[model samples]
Target: MAMEGYRGFLALLVSALLVGFLSVIFTLIWVLHYREGLGWDGTALEFNWHPVLVVTGFVFILGIAIIVYRLPWTWKCSKLLMKSIHAGLNTVAAILAIISLVAVFDFHNAKKIPNMYSLHSWVGLTAVILYILQLLLGFFVFLLPWAPLSLRALLMPIHVYSGLFIFGTVIATVLMGLTEKLIFALPSYSSLPPEGVFTNTLGLLILVFGALIFWIVTRPQWKRPKEPNSVLLQPNGGAPEGVESSMAMNFGNVDKSDSELNNEAAARKRNITLDEAGQRSTM
Candidate 1:
């Protein structure tokens, strides 16, 4: 039953990821074929890079980064490797997102258009800033060797919640930006032009993608399996192994002699027998 549930969840996750990838591809096609192609020469077409990169990075890549830990295929790998992958993906996403912002700003400056004057701009900038901060905090606390274990434990929940909040903010900002672009670029947006309809559909797909990513990340059952003897190693060294490593980590690890373990097992068996006997008597 558990395997069936996991398979079902995996199917849903893959479907959502595919929808997001397609939506991003369609958005890029719409921009290049219908609106403007991408460039970096400070032309109006240069601005096209902003939306494309933002969608790819903030929406698509970030979604994958958020759910990387939840992927069942990574269960066999060490947690350290998974963490490295997660951080690496997020770093790439952040770099792409920053370049997208730079593209927008460069375009605006070249056109002599005022920047940060729109609600979309405000929300998007805020989201990016918060995302960068989240990344820095996560790196220093979780990845670096400076922080203690207690601090890492304390900050983990906050980091998770803020990450999800930033994801939602990015999606909301993208939706707003899409609406603003349609209103400005399409004269008949109020009358629902074809481009407007297509853009709205794309926006809906992005929203659904974000929702699915959030759902997968938050579901407790979908979390990655922690190894019983997993050890959080420092950057230098000092990692134990086997049962000793488990005890050192203190992740529900208890130190028990063989006799103690045997006694506990016998007690559990006796309790099960007593419970069965009581049930049979009641029947």
Candidate 2:
């Protein structure tokens, strides 16, 4: 695959970070300023925690998790370490999302409001549940030592696809939630009050951030470069089976000629035979 230069990738990455930052910051401003601050008191203030955590933890951090593999600074790190970082971020996102759900449920029950009655609620809950499953499967399939390389390879595509799908689902669910909240809270949402406009801007920022992440991840040239493992295997004269699978990402990089391995094996056998014969004769 033709690897693209870092200049373009860096530019897009910077833009993504900026947009994600703005989205989270805007969410905080909306809740703290316009919505009269946050709390855990089974009030609307507590419900405010939902949007704040979702944007900061779930949306922004999750976006970071998805594109982490493409980060140039992390290139020198072991693939296992990189995978850990990716999974760690996702786990944090899931935790925050669960907390946000608790906040919403508590506030609703306190206010005697019905729950799970809207499409936004349904989709959001479903997405979060699937996200959790994805995290667990990813840990077992990619991080665990027992899983064979072939299994990892087979599941990698599904893992990646599900992760992206969950991300997109959450984005859609968030947009729906925003619109729903505005319709009820603003009542005159058609007139576009300051709160409505500000919240809408937050939604737009989220869209931009999501787009940048997907673009970065889907670009073939932006994939993390494979390390050259053949150099390390040269001393052995032949590479171990599944050495390529161990690095996994560089399935094509580890290699040695069959003839070289055969020659080395024969020479080593002859040396052992000669040493044994000389020892016996001396005795």
Candidate 3:
């Protein structure tokens, strides 16, 4: 578990660093674009929100990645931890989704989008705030010992909602980024790895990589032991064997055969006689 947490932490930290580094490069590119104004008028690149959103998105991604991947405890003892991690990731993801969606709209009206750059800036700032909150919550979870397993279950709804939102937002952001004039102002497309490097299309790369990472980390734990004892039923108490098996058997109220009833009666009678005989001998 420690190893897993470390790996997750590293992944998030590295990804965040990359995003920060890239933000600088992109900002420089935008500045140069503003000065050149090849196709555009010499507008002072008034507060475009793209940079902010990009940085925000990166922060969100990093926070969610860390929360989802880190943490040593499982559903057994540290349910609260699991829930907190899940909630933290989902919360970051939710903010990211909202910003991404808004980015889509902003990019659509790139020319008329009031304070487009500012929008990006605010989104980044919000992302930073949300990430900090998530980190705080994560620390709380880490220190906790026992927690209800249901806590993790409780976060599923939010997680699902946040995840769906991300899908839509990513798609929208990619599309708008690709088609808008803002992209044209940036450095030559060839300079980047591909034409759609900064477009919504790049989300596909993120999706694919995210999926791969999840698979790698959660692929499989050690093969489960074949024996029942090895199952190691959690502390959460469940039904007894008789009740569980009885429900499974689904035995309707059917009458027993006369012979079977007679045999059972005979067995009881024989046990009584044996007890009586033993008692008499002892006397």
Candidate 4:
């Protein structure tokens, strides 16, 4: 009913879920269409690419994107350390995305599905390394105490956008790689055979992990405390009660000596004491 803390984390998580959901749906359609394989010869599937590689690369990119959603609230306290890590990771991810985009144009072949496998490989590897560093920094930020709030606000969007662009680039390049085979097939850089258990398992894990992170970030927090008012009814907003009546008492002793207030007698005594003090002073 009521909103709680960490709304941003929740929103990011929701976005990640959507990305992963769309990814699964897209992969399913492509795989079913190309049940045999993504070959040089065109088939029922319009794209001249392997559904498997596209699926793998898409999942990989999605993994980074989804993980970015989880990084923000990972440590709210140590903002400085967190910001530094976040900034570094964003820079790296952006570089990798741009490089991957470049490799897209370097497709070796046009007809047999371009296998700019080297570019994809290098970019993917670097992205994964940076993603891991980002994860470590997210955890590190939680432990720090002096980090600034403003820095966190600025860095979060950069991290998220870079991830989104990276995912987009991966999809585009994978399509190019699928449309035509590499111009010169390098034995070392070929894709693994489709239906490999390891690959499928990894994809499933990414899907599951992304879903979990999204669910966490988007989920609503507990109800916040209501503000207080000055009304004397119950401080807790409960009904007021009547006050008891008792006489206010003066606690002074009525029988005290009046001599203490006898100003004339006190003045005479002061004069006598002064006379005696004058004699003493002179002596």
Candidate 5:
């Protein structure tokens, strides 16, 4: 990113971290002060783990993973290292999500509360399961050596969409979970009790945090600029990777020998560019 963009990114980055950490702190207060301290035992304390882990792992770290590429400083990092970090953070999120799921079920079974009874549980579990699948696919396809660039490009859109989709879905599910917990635990929630108000505020913070991340991710200007050594920069020519990698692919080997192949390349490139430019101008 340019220096000017770096300043903007830095501002938003700090804002995101502040909100994210506030969420973590608020979750702690809610669980420890209101819901009782955390524990692995089959009790409400055990269920408390659900909210904490979800807030930290799914809402916070998972969000960071989603936008890691947008961090201007990390733009200098190797794409493979970035991929590893992305996969690592997501792994943590998935592990925490899975543990939270277990915590909920364990508490439910111990108290005979009935499992998968609420919309929160249903959707939350679905998100976790999907998240795990996403994590596995990302690690195996992106981080592993055997996956080809063609395969990566083909799946890139689906991968990107599913990631953001899951992130948004998890946030919505968290909101539902918070509300559900408040209703069950606080009979006076309708009156807007102190705990209820605080929890609602925390939810709002999380929602805003998500909005900021989406803004950072979706903005064309904030997308990561291609590094010099990026696969797209290779001589063979290929479409750039996700985020800021533009749809620049060599139609043919621009440096290749033979006039016939050269003509073909020129023809293809000219046709596509003119067509695309015309569409944009029309738009």
Candidate 6:
């Protein structure tokens, strides 16, 4: 059977992406129109780049990178191609995040403001560092040709958990950063000015988007379907028999019997043998 609820999951993914993009756009407008605009020179306006780029890259682009493999259409593509796209998008997000940090630092230094003073800064920096480390480990373990299969298998769970954790952490950091910005920039954020209202709405949208993305990624039934020609096959150039049936056994949906496994294996072996024999006869 096909993956259950995949259509609903896909719809949610699209909705989350739309909400996320709107939030980013709203943030830019808030910063540019109501507050200082973006710049690179040491000014308050220059610091606007920090929030804009962080929301765009760290939240939106990074989120897409994390979920690219879950896209239904991507199942038809080679696993290697998907992996390359995932890595490349993450690299771009990292670069944007780094530039955003530079913008914040430059503005603070120019204004003689202390850096890393707020809880937002502390958590945000930690999240960025952890994210970069995760990316590096994922690249070396999964994408590179040198890593052993055993090592990849061992690290796979850790990598997945840590990635989800970091994604949540980044969203939390963004919310904290928004709160900090509103407190500092708005004279009466409690009373709710237009800017404050807009900012708060943007934060809510971001929170919803992040949550939806996480839900989509975590749902096992929403996982991409395994293609017949997947690159995940054994080096001997054949898909492993009984993998799916074995999984069904755990759910009591399929009977577990040695006879069944043996028969399946025997059939696969017989097919291979017949194919080889036919090839020889043709030659």
Candidate-wise lDDT, in order = 0.85, 0.88, 0.45, 0.45, 0.86, 0.85
- The Cα RMSD of model 1 versus the native structure comes to 11.8
Question: Model 2: C-alpha RMSD to truth?
Answer: 9.1
TM-score of each: 0.80, 0.81, 0.40, 0.30, 0.81, 0.80
Number of the predicted model whose lDDT against the real structure is largest: 2
Off by over 4 Å in 6: 1-3, 227-283
Residue 9 lDDT in model 3?
47
* Candidate 5 off by > 4 Å: 1-4, 232-283
Residue 244 of candidate 5: its Cα lDDT? 32
Model 5 lowest lDDT segment of ten:
243-252
Candidate 5 per-residue C-alpha lDDT over 1-283 given as tens digits, one digit per residue, 9 for 90 to 100: 4634777878888899899999999999988898879998898999999999999999999989988988777878888899999998999998899888899899999999988878988888889888888888898888997887777767778899999999999999999999999998999999999999999999999999999888878887888877765563222344344323332223234334466787999999999999999999999
Question: 1-283 in candidate 1: lDDT tens per residue?
Answer: 1333687688879888898898789789879877868788988788888889899999999999999887777788877788789889899989999999999999999999999999999999999999999999988888777897656766888899999999999999999999998888889899987888889999999998988998888788887765876544432334433545556657444444656798999999999999999999999
Q: How do these models rank on lDDT, best leading? A: 2, 5, 6, 1, 4, 3
Q: Which residue pairs come into collision in candidate 6?
A: none
* CA shift of 137, model 2, Å: 0.3
Clashing pairs in 3: 47-117, 47-118, 48-116, 48-117, 49-116, 49-117, 49-120, 52-120, 174-200
Model 3 per-residue lDDT tens digits across residues 20-106: 445435544543444332122223332244433443454334434533533333324344445565655555655654554455454
Quick one: RMSD of model 3?
10.6
Model 3 vs. true fold: TM: 0.40
- The global Cα lDDT (0 to 1) of model 2 is 0.88
